[model samples]
Target chain A: MNPQPSLNALQSILETLLPQMEQGKFSKVECHFVRALLEQFKNHSRVFAELELSTRHLKEALGETENAANTLLTLAEDLQRDERTEDIGLQISEACAFQDIVGQRLKLVQKTLYSYVDFLALMGTTTQTSPATIMSGPGFTGEVISQDDADRLMG
Target chain B: MAVSKDMPILIVDDFKTMLRITRQMLAQLGFMNVTEATDGVDAIEKMGQKDFALIISDWNMEPMSGYDLLKHVRGASKTPTVPFVMVTAERKPENVIAAKKAGVSNYIIKPFNAGTLKSKLMAVLGPF
Candidate 1:
């Protein structure tokens, strides 16, 4: 048989295999597969940073949209008194459209922020367990539960 | 000499936002010297290398928890007298008992306002 591949060649093979491991199709893979996935995760700080920045911007945009909707509602109410004017119906329609757009954008922003928040919350609270399960016995107590678990418990 | 403005304060918590908020709140409260650790192990390593007047730690952390850090501190001769207070969401009786057993100076429950934090710190540190 041919000599075993060098450490670098083995690492390259594992690196090539990581995507399959991440897809959960290669469940029987070794610890190195998990390590490669974790290493990939560690290098994705920019993704999290962008998500944070996008969440901030989305929040600000939602706030501005809410303010605009409020202002439009006020304008529509004020214009309602002049029922005969052609512009009044147009203003009301525009206001309704603005409110709808604002509502949709707010929902989108909420979903985006919720996804990012949930991801960070997971990272914040997850506890790594060793393969031996030596530290997994019942004596352990009072650790903070993950955000998802906390939400489920509280809800 | 009294604890100067430049003396670092170790703020230990697993949550990054909580750490940032605590650091900001401490800065607002006139404690300018603040350092942060994401967990008890990081806090202990920092404490081992330097002297901090106070340790504000969250009771819940993976691997080396805050209670473990408190025990470690108590066991170490250099930092036995360091004022340690648990700032955690854990309000359970057993946790409190364990913290007290480990010689925690005070316990502050989470969602605590700045005023409550100041009051607890005053209670532990004798009005400052």
Candidate 2:
């Protein structure tokens, strides 16, 4: 058996070399598939980078949200003794602004994801199954059978 | 010149949410006087109408970017010496160099908090 190159490493190498190969001789289907694959790879790389950025932003947003919630909880606990409640309230408000930043970045991520799906469909790689017919959850689509109905069917 | 909390400050960003966030953060830092611009062009228009003590602007925007705005600010103007802080998601050395060449007083990366904002402001405007 021959050793195989890592897909992760191969992707980067191909990304650099594919454009040079774009002008090479090939059949119609081969050309189409190659170009589509190259495009898909670029789009995947972009989406991956966007996802990483969104993940970082989300982590920061969640941390700030937790801080705000904890501050509020503490203020609620020591309502009578805390003199800096107003300052803490303002701090919480400032901390909650993380959602706006995260929301903006996540919107970019969502747009890139949608573009990925569109690219797949364009390349004729998408399945024939209608989006509505696809399973949304474990038990969401199937019929709700009673225990009696199950027993009767089994019997 | 002493940096006063009462001095008018301008924040330019394409995102309304960011404008709100920056404004709220500045308010928390005791800087009550603040103005906003949606883009570099708008910021220039605002600059024409009034003088800002400091300018905090996002690097990316349509029609005119923050780099363009910085150049315009640094160009022949009454407030040419005003401190310009570049806020951006880009961390590339080339970007920092370009901003420095364009006369940016300071730089700030996104995903920053009020504390970070305060530190940058202090660096640019001196202690408040």
Best by lDDT: 2
**Stretches of model 1 off by over 4 angstroms after superposition:** A1-155, B1-6
lDDT by residue for model 2 (A39-86), tens? 656655655665565455556556656765776677656656776766
What CAPRI class is candidate 1? incorrect
Residues B1-128 of candidate 1: C-alpha lDDT, one tens digit per residue: 34354556888986676676677667656898888888888988897778898889976666677889899988899889888988765545566667787888887765454666677777677655
Candidate 2's TM-score reads 0.60
Q: What is the DockQ of candidate 2?
A: 0.05
Error of 1 at B110 (Å): 0.6
TM-score of each: 0.46, 0.60
lDDT of 1 at A16: 76
Clash count in backbone of candidate 2: 0
For candidate 2, lDDT tens digit of each residue in B46-128? 98899898999987676798889999999955867999988765445556677887888887766467887887788778887
